[model samples]
Target: MTIQNRERFLNNVAQHLGRERKTKNVERPSSSLMPQWQVFQHHSQDELADELELQCHSIHTTCKRTNAENLHTVLQETIEELKGQRIIASDDSRNETFGISSLYEDLQKKGITCHIWNSADGQYNLDYAESADVGITFSDITLAESGTVTLFNNSGNGRAISLLPRSYIAIIPKSTLVPRMTQAAKHIHEAEQEGHGVASCVSFITGPSNSADIEMNLIVGVHGPVEVTYILVENR
Candidate 1:
């Protein structure tokens, strides 16, 4: 942001608060009780994965386990189960690392259309996502406590890849698994401190879109994907 815009934003905030904008930065208070740092801190990776699976049931999401070697086969099977015809996937390097690059070719051989997100395509990306039967992405971070997947969206992996498709699939590596959002935030903050920066859009998706009406009738797939499947890849 420009200096003038930054000052304008602060002025607007100060006016709303009925106080003048302070020139100096204020030091934050620290608490002695830090439970967030302790919850599930001792749990092993395997234990975290188990917790993720257990929470998935409550969130109305399907959880699948696989290894790096079988990821391609398992993913293909999952696409078939979802009856996906036209697929849209993020152009994430981790996909190639986990043996997914060849699967796209195999899918094409079977006449399944797979469109990888391309920045050069511009509007065509959104157009493809709208008609896509399934959208696939690799989770940057997996929260076991809430069965949530964190997507650090970028030019190559746009938010539409996850929000516009009928069905969604997230491939999570074992190393990205964390106890919850606490650890995820910490990782991002530390990365920024180390000059690694962060994605402009970080999406935390738990499960398929759902809502309840005034009558308390629960509706699924109201605003997003009708179904979501999380594939946890071990030893990735």
Candidate 2:
């Protein structure tokens, strides 16, 4: 075909493609305005704890090769063991007013070195947390259905406290426990939209850090904490 004829054919095809694209875009719904779905809710902290226990038990049973067993007892024992191994508890305003001080005192009497990093002092020192045997922090939210803890990096507790330590013990209040990750993520996303910016990092830790990267042999604490203890403060 002649050059002019080829140009006319290409222009017509481009126009047709543009019209089809516009039609598809118009048909699509706006995600921003869509109603956000709620994943899980609990009537009380006891119920949440029960659900968490069941889920953790299932994981422990299925991952039998890993020698996983009795998460509740493990968590409790870990806390006790950490007390003997030097543990630092991050302080928060909510914790101070929510009976955490008494808990800290109890832990201290047991020989745990609990440190209170107030809002005025601000931020966690990665080097300090790294040197510590264990770093304990509280989660803003937790998912009972999956035995997952949701931590906001920028809040009273930073990611370093959880990531830098050899062991991590998180004290989660029952009231803040959700059913699944979907609910937790939605809450965080909404918080970001409201100017919180979703913290620096959002960690969904189900268990201790582990890997089977070397010769397919399982190794724990390769990159992160070897032990992860979750103390569900049911009454509180």
TM-score, each model? 0.89, 0.66
- lDDT tens digits, residue span 27-133, model 2: 64557643233334433656767777677664331111111123334443666665535555565665554455566677678776666544454544555676777
What's the count of clashing pairs in each model shown? Answer: 0, 0
Alpha carbon deviation, residue 171, candidate 2 (Å): 1.2
Measured on C-alpha atoms, candidate 1 has an lDDT of 0.93
* Model 2, runs deviating above 4 Å: 1-19, 22-47, 58-78, 102-112, 118-124, 194-198
Residue 91 of model 2 has an lDDT of: 57
Residue 171, candidate 2: alpha-carbon lDDT: 66
Residue-wise C-alpha lDDT for candidate 1, range 86-163, written one tens digit per residue: 999999888778989899989999999999999999999999999999999999999999999999999999999999
